[model samples]
Target: MSRRILVIDDEPGIRQALGQLLEYEGFEVKTASGGAEGISLYDSYRPQLVFLDVKMAGLDGLEVLKRLRQADPTATVVMISGHATIQTAVEATQLGAYDILEKPLDTDRVLVLLRNAFENRLLSEENARLRETIESRYEIVGRSFGIRALLERIDKVAATPARVLITGENGTGKELVARAIHRGSPRAKKPFVEVNCAAIPSELIESELFGHMKGSFTGAIADRPGRFEQADGGTLFLDEIGDMSASAQAKVLRVLQDGVVTRIGGSKPVQVDVRVLAATNKNLEDEIAAGRFREDLYYRLNVVPITVPALRERREDIPLLIVHFLQQLAARDGLPARGISEDALRRLQELEWQGNVRELRNTVERLVILASHATIGAPDVERLVGRRSAESPGLGGLLDIATFEEFKQAAERAYLLAKLRTFDWNVSETARALDMPRSNLYKKIERYALQRETVE
Candidate 1:
């Protein structure tokens, strides 16, 4: 569709000339003779770009620009004036004018400005669409009472500028909750910046959250806006907040309290209006009691606490989740849609999902990838879960696991050891067999304290 451009001027010749020029350039043109008519047309047409005469008869361009900006802050209005002054241009810019055009409009400059304005609008629209697509990917997908109640709470707080702290076990969709809130909020059109505190190194956490100036640190080559600045006027999701360093936590608390952030090696404190949503899989209260987390920071973040129920707590939604995952995965990967037998689904529900919804999705993906038939059966389910189950009596059996973390560690150790044995301790071959980077494999080996077993 052609972009709409509005020209508001009292002079008939200028209006006619500009209208003809814009129309010839393939823009949908709308011309108004007076300021009142221009404002009315703007209200009706909602043009993407507007060219208004600064010295109109009754209501001037400045007033119209102010009104347009009041209606839509992102409106693109370029002021055209025969007798232009620096003060007038500055005032127009302060009133949110896109640019100022000299009285005798240069055809090349007009075309270039129009092209740039439309390109910017297109980019902004594309960004909004991408954000929507991202939010859709993390849509909450259950109908249980727990999920329904959570959705209700989300609706209640989504429109407001309240801080939310989500708590749940790993893979229980804490980030999903945060994204849902952002998608439903008033600032939905703005950025949604996320930071994983646990994934980033402690030394760089400050820069990652609050940004840094050029030459701030050894590796700082250029000025960088941190997550907080990037998320200005929108939502900032801080995941794994419990893992943040003490210094970073204090800085985060200050930002939350004062709505301002100072970059590393910079003296200026930049103010940002951001809605913060934080998530953690660990119990922050316990961390505070253990002196690892600050109590004051906890209270600041836990304004409206939301605890996502574990998969076991909402088992009724397992079948629905299974079906959703199956269809979604099949569609995404261009695989034939697969079905899970009732017995298979039942077996799945009976097992504990220590990783919650994430574990379930991974299991479904594994089955779809490895299943021989279109319909997955109980035996297939058993074999997949059986390998990771603590009770299975084999190389993968982890019967001694006392906690979920221990269970995961034992499974990793067993799997790594078995793969290493299968490949005759060839690290490259074993890493290839496991489809992991060699460095990651080596790290896992070190983390699990894996050692070669002596032959009898």
Candidate 2:
């Protein structure tokens, strides 16, 4: 494919020479005599690159550059000047000209500028495409009442620099909400740094969030910027914040207060401009009461609160989600596209999805891979992902769990629920049978949000 170039200069000799040279180099060339003609042709020609002269009769170079940039912010333009001053060059650059060339244009320099400009354009194009893919991947795809409400809150908070605290059960897509907030913010083009507070060890979490100087600790070989520094001028997402060590939480609170972070072994505090977004499956209010999480940090981070609904809470949107996941799988993973029967979708919705949307997506992926037919039916779903059972989530569900803590919690919840049912919801009997304290059992029930079916 040939790239287009436009030469806008009052000098006939310069225009003809550049146009001929560009033509010989396999470029589609267009020549304009003056700035007025150049601006007029810009709309029609739509050339990828433009070379405009500084000295023009009607419209000046800076004005033309500004107008061109206004017409298309992505315009690639270079200024050609016979007698140029530093201020003139600076002004051209500020007006969005790609580069400034002296009157006697060097063939080598012009070609080099074109190469560089086109290369940068390609990079910008690729970045735009990647951003689109990322946005689509992290899209919140539900129209359910719960989802609509959640999205409404997200929209209300997204445009502000206010800190957000996202709360939800495991696999409920809290990260999606955080990403959505970042995407909608003024800092959308900036970095969105994430740190799984629960994943890092207690011994190293402070250093991880605040950076470490060389030889600060046993394994600290070189100076490294932490999550706070890396996310400066962007967003910092602290996932599973309830699991963060208390010491680290205090440091985080200080950072939020002063916007300054000191390295592990460094005294100097580096200032940062970051919008912090924190998420946790655990009830942070409970965590604070239990002294497991810091109250000060919670207040700082919870300027805006967003709770993502569990999948079961919005079962009506299950079909829409199935369709979305199918399309996503096909586009992103190159998986075979398959349809789900109404019965199958309904069956899926009926199940108690303890693992939330994450669990459903996994189940969908399994069906796409293992189901025999082109379209998935209820029988296939039952055989593959089991039936619509509310009380019992099979051993497969435990095996599907990714994190050890989550597995332990799920196992404990299922065990406790079963024991309570066996005792006919007699708390005393279940507590006695499990050889656990009644108060402890009650606390567990509250933690898991477990309840009995009410007889209507």
Candidate 3:
């Protein structure tokens, strides 16, 4: 499809000429006489780009730009004016106009401006898409007290250049928290380099942290920069830091202390400005006690410690996470958005997500793609959770085995049995369990067709 452009000017000649020029440039163009008509056309056409006259009858270009921005924050608006003034240009810019064009229009300049504007618009949309991908990929969606507190801490820590150590179980979103911190920081525009200490070979760890020159080692085919050099002026996220060898830990400590790195086979140390963020599932203090990790380096990296709560600790957030994952999956698959049935959602909430956010996201994605109906019900959840059970041997699978009706019956039976056992088989215990002032548990005992068995 051709790119759409809308032109709004009081002068008919200017509008016609510009529209023709743009159309010749292979753009689909539309023209409006003034601000009112321009807004109406904008609403109807939803052009990718707009050109507006600065001076108009009812509403000026700046006001039009403001209105357009209000309607669509991402809409690109370019301002045109024959009687250009510094004040008018400034006002247009303040209102978020893409650029100011002075008339009689310079065809070459106009073409250049339009090309640049379109390219920038593409870049802007791409950036938004990338951010969205990152956000969804991170998959930390929730509004519970625990989630809110964690977000608040992330916001506060992101504003500073503090060395942070995030400790959590595997799959608890420590890396996600790290990325969120980097995205919210001043260095967001710069690179965010990640190094997994456990994944890299111990022998190559030094070269990985600090780049190697040509022929630096047996496999040194060419010069390459390390994570520290690449992450200069940004963030270097060292995941599984506890797995790093003692030699690598010492080198990391030096970088943190001196803010400099020396590449292998290179004489001079290169200065680098980088914020360090490290995460690990292991207890670093234990590693230090066991003589596997350096206490000094641990203290340096642990200036600010953040612990991500596991899913089990914040069960209230499970429903919100389910919806977030489904929406994200639907967007990715180009399908109409769908919702989970209340029964399914309730079952999900009861699950102890040992794998935390990562596991929950995977399960939701699976259900969204594989589920046959528009709304996932309890049966679908049972199937998904049941599949997981076959893979792992534990109580994790047991809870998912009970059908909806079976679960309801089991809950009722357990309530009555607990009351009978607690009160030494008193009828009052049954009544209390049934939430009745009198004849409560007895009525439930009769309603559920309860039977008594003597203790051995």
Candidate 4:
């Protein structure tokens, strides 16, 4: 499809020349004699780019630009005028003009400017889409009292410049809470950088946090800015901060105290204005007692503490979370909408999710992909959770049995379930691997009530 270009100029000669030139270059061009007609055409045509004369007879170029921008904030308008002063150019720019072209315009310069302007617009649109996707991915979904209270705390903490320390069990969405605070803060438009302390090796964590100059370390090919510098005038999230080495902890403490970060191999301290939001699944108090984490750093980061409640603590929200996750997954994967029976949802709510919201979402996605029926039922839930239960350590491991028959039965059950999962419930393949007939394996699976999921 050809790009649409609109030329809004009072001079018929200039308009006709540009229109012909743009049309020859494969752009769909529209011309307007004055600002009033230009604005009307803009509303109707919705062109990708606009070239407007600054000094027009009717509505001035700046006024039209403002009106167009107010109608569509993403409008890309370039101002052109034969009598353009520095002050006039500045005013046009302040009114959101994309560029100011002096009149008797060079065709070469106009084409080059159009190319750059369109490229920038494309990049901006892509970034906006990505930002929306990220926000949706990290959306906090719940309506329970615990969730309400957490949201209230987030609102209060986000308005301040206090350092936040979010504590929660693994998979409880600590990072999501941290992002919510960052999005709510005054620095929402600025960078929101994150570092996972546990993922990086202890030896390289210092360089990762404080950066390093070229040749400072083995892999340092160029001077690099750390998370603090990258998140300048914004929010820096330190996830799994409890896993940070003691040396790194001390450096973090120093930065928190003075708002300055000195690179690993550099003497100069670079000043940074960053709000720190830290999260950890570990008990920092216990870590401090064990001499693992720094006491001063703990005190500094704990200025505004938040604890994300476990999934089981808010069972009422499980259904809502499930619906949210399922909808998001369906939309993202281009899959048909899936539903869960009331009994199935209730069964989910009854279980204790040690892994919390993350686990529930994963489970929902799995069901969406693997369920045979459009509406997931209790039996489906049972089969799915049963497979997971067999994998987890349970009372069978701790219980002592007196008879050989009891022990043999339990071992056989566990063995058969593991084999079935390995084969993904392919009866023939599992039977072959187990050195048994397919019929016998089926009988055993039925006797044990073992369920296998089918993945498409």
- Cand. 2 TM to true fold: 0.80
The CA lDDT at 315 in model 3 is 73
Across 302-362, the per-residue lDDT of candidate 2 in tens digits comes to: 8877777777667788888888898888888999999889999888878767778888899
lDDT of 4 by residue, 105-187 (tens): 89999999989988998899889988888899999998876687788888888989999989877899999999999999999
Clashes of each: 0, 0, 3, 0
User: lDDT of all predictions, in order shown?
Assistant: 0.86, 0.86, 0.83, 0.86
Ranking by TM-score: 2, 4, 3, 1
Best prediction by TM-score: 2
What is the alpha-carbon lDDT of model 1 when measured against the actual structure?
0.86
Q: What is the TM-score of each candidate against the true structure?
A: 0.61, 0.80, 0.69, 0.75
Off-target runs (Cα >4 Å) in candidate 2 are 337-347, 373-380, 391-456
Model 3 over residues 1-456: C-alpha lDDT tens digits?
249999999999998899999989999999999899999999999999999998899998888899999999988898998888999888888889888988899999999998898888888888888888777777567776556767877888999999899987677889989999999999999999999999999999999999999998999999999999999999999999999999889999998999999999988899999999999987676688889999999889987777776676567888888887787777776655778888898887876676778898888888877777888888988876763322443333325434775446546655665577567667765566656766555666654434343323
Mark the 10 consecutive residues where model 2 has the least summed lDDT. 447-456
Candidate 4, which ten residues in sequence have the lowest lDDT sum?
Answer: 389-398
**lDDT score at residue 324, model 1, on the 0-100 scale:** 84
